[model samples]
Target: MKKYFLKLYQYNAWSNKRVLGTLQRQNVNDPKILSLMGHVVAAQFLWLHRIKGLPPPDVKLWGEYSLDQLLKLSEKAGKEWLEFVESNDNFDRQLTYTNYVGEPYTNNVEMIMVHLVNHSSYHRAQVAMLLRQKGFEPINTDFITYDRVITGQLKE
Candidate 1:
């Protein structure tokens, strides 16, 4: 499960970098794209910490940051997430956490992990659409493509 999530994370990081570069090269002036990426990262941090029974992250919204800065922050966040996964074994699952809507949810660690990936994937798709609406070419981030890139073969 960790490996799967890690693969998704790595692919996400790559896709974001591609989009960020496109925005930079095209000289995009809107900061909302960066803000959206920040939201994605912030949400991941909040959910992962919640699942791990840790304090939530403090980011309320995305802020202005150069592409390099955002990438660095993402790297840091990814490292923390990886460490959290490393500390837990498969038996440590089913954490209880509250959602923003004040609903109680009991989620296994693996489910929560997949949720994080899917959550990010959904938002990243939003970012891509937002970019396309603004006339930028967003990178294609299909999971199969990522697997092919990682394994050096076209995966079915």
Candidate 2:
């Protein structure tokens, strides 16, 4: 189970860097794009803090960050998540955390890990659509693409 989640985190980090690189290469500093990416990075921190029994950071979920800021934050969050997954072995451990709306919920570590990746993927799709509408091609961040590239089946 730990191995599986580590692979997922690896994919997540790779895909995030791809998206960030695409945005940089396309010279896309769109507010919406930055905001979505910021939210993704912020949510990763939030969930990690919850899992680690730490307080949440002072960050706005929908905040619009500069492209450079997003790049740094995304990279930091990815590293932290990867390290957390590597150090932990109990994915089935349940955690209780409060939601943004002040609601309480309990979920196991596995579910939260899955949710973080899925949440990023969902927003990345939105970022891709926005880029396409603006006459730019988005980089492929699909899991299979990541797998292939890592395995040397496709050149990155």
Candidate 3:
């Protein structure tokens, strides 16, 4: 499980760098793209906080981050997550938390970790679609595609 989380984190960092490079080259300053990225960051931060029993951040604050700032924030978050997984010894994966809507939710540690990755992937895909609509092709966010390109893996 730890290994899987690490792979997901690596994929996220690589994909983030790719998207940042694309946005820089295209000079994509679309407000919607920025907004979507902000949501992605907010979602990650919110879950991390939940996992750590920390208070949630103000979602509105994410708007203060420009694309470049968001990229840096994402990198920071990635590093923080890696350090967290490295340092934690408790392997008990079960924890429960309520959602923003006051709904009951139960998730083990592994499930929470997977949720973090999947949640970001989903929002990033939306951002990519938005970028394409605005005439910019964002980097592919597919996990297998990422592994194949980054590791030069041949299809079986």
Candidate 4:
């Protein structure tokens, strides 16, 4: 289980970097893309804090961020999540945390980790869609793409 999650986290980090790089290369400053990416980064941090049994940070979920800021935060979140997954082996441990709306919920570590990756993937697709609508070609950040690159079947 740990090995599986570690691979997922590795792919998550790679895909995030790809998306951020594409945005930078295209000089994309679309407000929707920025907002969506910001939310993704913020949510990663929020979940990390929750998983560590800490209170959520006081910040807007959809706060505006400059491209550079988003890139930095995304990099930080990716590294931290990778480290967290690598160091923790208790995937079945239950975590109880409060939602942003003050609702309480309990979920195991494995489920939360999966949700984190899937959540980012969902927003990344949104970012891709917005880029396409603006006549920009979206970078391929699929899991298979990452796998192929890692296996030397494709160039990154």
Candidate 5:
């Protein structure tokens, strides 16, 4: 489970950098795209904080951040997730946390991790489409595409 989480986190970082690079090529003027990207990192931090029994950071869901700022935030989240995955042993460990609407829920580690990655992916797709609508071609951030680049023969 740890190895699986590590792989997912690694892939998440790789995909994030690709998307950030594409967004960086633009002038960082699109508020919609910026909010989506910012929310990715903000939600990651919020979840980590919740899992660690800490208060959420002063980041809003739709916060505006420049691409460079988001790049730094993305790197921070990746490093934190990698460390957490390596340190934790029980994937089924349960955690209780409150959502933005003050609704509380308990979830196992595996589910939380899956939700984190899937949430980012959902927003990344939105970012890609937003770029497309603006006459720009977004890079392919698909898991299989990343896998092909990292493992030419599918060694994993």
Candidate 6:
């Protein structure tokens, strides 16, 4: 499970960098793309903090980070996730954390990790749509495509 999640995180990080880079080169100031990108990184930060049992009220779910800062924040979140995924001791552990609205919940680590990936994919699709409408070709972010590249099934 740990190894599987590590791959998923790798995919997540790869896809995010592509999207951020595309946005940076195209329209970094687009409000919708910026909002989506900001939310994606902000949510990741909050979840990582929660998983680490860190203090609440420190991370924001909808933080408005600058376009230039998205990559830095994404890199920081990737490092945090990689450190956790590299340690498999508690992969099946359940975590208890309160949501942004103060609603408490309990979820296993695996479920949380999967949710994080899916959440990012969902928002990425939204950003892709926005990018298309703005006459930009969004990066291909499918998980299987990423897997094929990583597994030597496809050329770079």
Best by lDDT: 2
Runs in model 6 with CA error above 4 Å? none
What is candidate 5's local distance difference test score?
0.87
Q: After superposition, how far is residue 151 of candidate 6 from its true place, in Å?
A: 2.4
Q: Considering lDDT, where higher is better, how would the candidates rank from best to worst? A: 2, 4, 5, 6, 3, 1
Instruction: Give one digit per residue, the lDDT tens place, for model 2 in 1-156.
Output: 999999999999998999999999999999998899999989999999888989888777988799999899999999999999899888898899898888999998889999999999999999999999989899999999999999999998
TM-score of each: 0.78, 0.98, 0.83, 0.96, 0.92, 0.92
List, residue by residue over 1-156, the lDDT tens digit for candidate 6.
Answer: 877888999999988988998888886578778888888988888888788888753545676667778889888888878888887556788898888889989999789989999999999999999999989888889999898989999874
lDDT of each: 0.71, 0.92, 0.75, 0.90, 0.87, 0.85
- Lowest-sum lDDT 10-residue window in model 4: 52-61
Per-residue error at 81 for model 3, in Å? 1.2
Model 5 worst lDDT run, 10 consecutive residues: 147-156
What would the per-residue lDDT of candidate 5 be over residues 4-78, giving only the tens digit for each residue? 888999999889888998877766468898899999989988988888788887778788887778999989988
- On TM-score, the leading prediction is 2
Q: Between 2 and 6, whose TM-score is larger? A: 2
Q: What lDDT score goes with residue 91 in model 6?
A: 72
Model 1 pairs in collision:
none
Please tell me which model should have the higher TM-score, number 1 or number 3: 3
Encode model 4's per-residue lDDT on 1-156: one tens digit a residue: 999999998998888889999999999999899999999889989999999977786546899998999889889988998898888877899998888888999999889999999999999999999999999989999999999999999987
lDDT tens digits, residues 69-92, model 3?
878877877787777777776646
Q: What's the lDDT for candidate 6?
A: 0.85
